[model samples]
Target: MDFHKLKKELITYSKEIGIDKIGFTTANPFDELKSRLIRQQELGYQSGFEDPDIEKRVTPSLLLEEPHSIISIALAYPSKMNERVESKKGMRRGIFSRASWGLDYHHILRDRLKKLEEFILTRVPDVRLKSMVDTGELSDRAVAERAGIGWSGKNCAIITPEFGSYVYLGEMITSIPLEPDSPIEDQCGSCTKCLEACPTGALVQGGQINAQRCISFLTQTKGLIPDEFREKIGNRVYGCDSCQTACPHNKGKNFHFHGEMEPDPEVAKPLLKPILTLSNREFKNKFGDVSGSWRGKKPIQRNAIIALAHFKDETAVPELIDVLVKEASPVSRGTAAWALGKIGGEPAFAALVKAKVVETDSEVRGEIEKALNYYK
Candidate 1:
């Protein structure tokens, strides 16, 4: 009946339950986003991780019957780790991006959505609702932008004034006719920081990204990283945040509002050499809870090898040699071959020469050859 009063109640309950921000918007089809998605698809810019169906992604009505309005919620995560892990002379560490610093945000955001759903059910007993996080067909950023959660920043992140771009976003589509909130004004006028700071130039101009070239997206792929981007990836074992970290809007905006989001320094910034040797069980036990580990340990290990190369970590040369000779995944072995070359010594060079004789995989052999050249 009184939808306005109900919206007020939902906002109050959301804050009480740790939702950092909440907003409402009509369930009209996202025409603009659909066009952009088409363009991204045409240009081969998509990361291959998004929903393939353009209609399903932009049309909320298809997701839920007669969806009248959408509710968007944001949970702020800490940008800075309160505790620090020391990287000594002989030991180097790789950093997981801020989003993956703590617990997997999917679990945290889902918990908040579940609470909101229960609260809504109490007031509107027959309310029809659908909720989703990053993996959902509906675009979380589009919903958040329409719902006034934040402006779409140049980095392609929803930038909330209070929390900057360091916030996890999710949404619920409902049959309730809640009043829609106005979208925020674009604040990234003439700011090329994100575009300039992108290592692979993934940020195309402004307000758009070529996900294929994005270091964040590349780190998540379960294959050999392109040779051009490998050196640019540096020590990022998970996602890359150069774009967000470069945004002026995110300055001094760290918020440790939720306990689940606190980083375990050792897990978030672990020693590079240890990651090279993690068993599947060991990787799961240590990084299983973080969002970045969703692709399993192969990509992380691959990135760890690259990070060792980035640092030219001589200490990791032995472990990298083992991976080059014995790792099951070709991506891992190939990456290790590259790392060994980057950290060249008599032993590393000898191992590459040895592996060159027996390595059958064309890709692995190619990487070994490349490493040998680099070593010379």
Candidate 2:
């Protein structure tokens, strides 16, 4: 079998199936990435969401027995929405990052991978292959960078010359020894825009991120956000895009090739207040298809409270007071307590004082005390 011919055919088929870009590389262990990850761990920068096993992350053989090559694919997502939702005073809305603008990318990329697998199976009947996306143990960015899909950008994303970093990445390991593509040169030369633009300074330096300080990671946590980051979080209810949006390469790189990749403006920038009252079924019905909803409504709700405070929406005060008095989740109630403090008025101040007396949960009461302290 001519593996080179097969690689070319695979690239063509990938483009036909909405894969914006594809590249191939030898599946040797990611030696350089292993060291960087070790340093990342030692510096306490990991988000605790990734797999803890270092070997499985860097070694392709562990994921796929006798893996000889890796095929990396990228699907570009649109950076700007064609339709805009009003985020003005009376109709404030929370913004999800560009990555979460459309349908969940995991499913989209998985579909493309499954198609690629079937195509390969028909050519080499006994080929061994394993595919993975963002949630997989194997690092998708490392595979993409080595596979020549893009250079690993200073913001810790795969920066394709064609798509910038606004691309969803996935990979497949195979037993076939396909000739590899050359990696693109890093073009971030002396650009400090991303690091300077990070609201929480999550971008520690070029090509390194402290995920603990990242608004994207913090918004996904199912707890009260630290007081310091609350104001900095602004109106982002899902992931943060400060680093990517600030990059000069991404300035004019918006693309909407796939139909499902187009964002529904209403869903992408939903009204902040409606998010607070979404029941599990309602939340699922509304945001269930978006990738950001994987953590469920709790974090989104908590972040919504923070967004309300960021807007100082006095109109949301009545509902926020209800959350403090009647909501079951201590995280939501606690976050609401803090929002009341941030958006202070007679009603908000009174609610915080009343909740301080009756809120039995230690954490919730602590938040209540902190909120009341603002009045002092």
**lDDT per residue, candidate 2, 251-359, as tens digits?**
9999989888899998899999999999999999999999999999999999999999999999999999999999999999999998899899999999998898888
What are the Cα lDDT values of the candidates? 0.94, 0.93
Error of 2 at 176 (Å): 0.5
Off by over 4 Å in 2: none
lDDT of 1 by residue, 35-60 (tens): 99999999999999998999999999
> Which 10 successive residues of model 1 have the least lDDT summed?
81-90
Q: Supply the TM-score for candidate 1.
A: 0.99
